[model samples]
Target: MGLQPIGRRVAAACAVVISGTAMTLLLPGAAAADHTDPPCGPAADACINLSENLSWLMSDGDVTFGPVPVSHGKPGYETPPGVFQMSFKNRDHHSSIYDAPMPYSVFFNGDIAFHEGSVDQQSHGCVRLPHDAARTYFYDLEPGDVVEVVP
Candidate 1:
């Protein structure tokens, strides 16, 4: 079969080495030929998959980190899905509304942020990540960076 066309981002991320009639594709964290594009487009620096409860950090469409577990809003307080710009960041933020400590907080949408929290528990509307992941996101993502939430 002939190869199909791929976008620049996908091609760049998937390193293909063709030798004779054999082709080898090298992708980190991939066990098979799963070369699907990241949840958000190339512009997104962070992408959250709500259904899968996973998140990723990207740079120019290449995944820099993750597929890490995350906890998002539950039921009535569902995490909104859309592309948003990272509003700001706070290393140690306390929630005035919930009276909770949010460390390494990276705010994207209004009142919604990615923070170090319990991944097993449901959040009000924020995306809860582990301490390490939260810290990485806070340090790596800057204001105006794209954060995309997908259902």
Candidate 2:
């Protein structure tokens, strides 16, 4: 009777250890899967959360990179909110209208793009990101991929 109780206690301990080990092994994969599933849904390759002033790179529903800081158009030139497809990319694009250097430009709307610029300053109806973030987004987004700008 005493031996039976001891055996049951041993079994319970073993079960706990096994369960813990299984959880430990499964956690990393679960985390990876979570990251791969895009926070913006499958249709969008990138999502710009305007109110947050942040952007993300997504694939297969996963967020591959970023919540990078961005600056959009100022009061008069407010960046339009809607879904737009990437129209083109230019590594050294210059804005003819503004006659300004717009490096690593990824155009998603008529004259607006995701480009390298001062995050602290507003853009001319464009989305401006820091150099590195703009470059990464420029390369990651392809023409025809969706860019959703949400409030």
Candidate 3:
């Protein structure tokens, strides 16, 4: 009777160890699955895949950061899909036309910019990323850097 409890504990410990090892073995594959090669290739500074709702920063044809979740304009206000260049940057930008706050903005096409916004919600003809991603992208891109938005 005394050994029965010890045996159960030993079995549980072994199960835990096996489960942990399995997770460790699977982690690399899972991370690899999360990343995909940017369609615009490594030369492009940034790529936004609207179909995937994904964005990334590229350098020398390699992804330096991202696969971050982004939100684009809703049905009525569709974000224009095309290749553009980063035209301007503003760390504390506000939209006078819409009277809305647009923080960490990186403007690519006219009034359309990549800025901090709710990832779960659509924007008004803008690419919206989470706060951290918006800031990272804003800093990563320079004026004249290529930004491709693809369907």
Q: Return model 1's CA RMSD, one decimal.
A: 8.8
For TM-score, candidate 1 versus 2, the one ahead is 1
Candidate 1 stretches greater than 4 Å from native: 1-37
- The TM-scores of all predictions, comma-separated, are 0.76, 0.73, 0.76
Each prediction's whole-model lDDT (CA): 0.80, 0.72, 0.75
Instruction: Return whichever of 2 and 3 wins on lDDT.
Output: 3
Q: Locate the minimum summed-lDDT window of 10 residues in model 3.
A: 8-17
What's the CA error at residue 18 for candidate 1, in Å? 32
Against the true structure, what is every candidate's RMSD? 8.8, 15.6, 13.1
Cα lDDT for residue 134, candidate 1:
76
Instruction: Summarize candidate 3's per-residue lDDT along 17-127 as a digit string, tens digits.
Output: 255446432221112358676677555788888988888777777676667789998999888888898899998999998899999999999999999999899998899
Order of models, best lDDT first: 1, 3, 2
Cα lDDT tens digits for candidate 1, 56-149: 8788887866666799999999999999999999999999999999999999999999999999999999999977667667777888999999
Which candidate achieves the best lDDT against the true structure?
A: 1
Which residue pairs of candidate 2 clash? 36-62, 37-61, 37-62, 38-61, 38-62
Candidate 2 residue-wise lDDT, 25-69, digit = tens: 222112323433323657787787778777777665556556667
What is the model-wide C-alpha lDDT for candidate 3?
Answer: 0.75
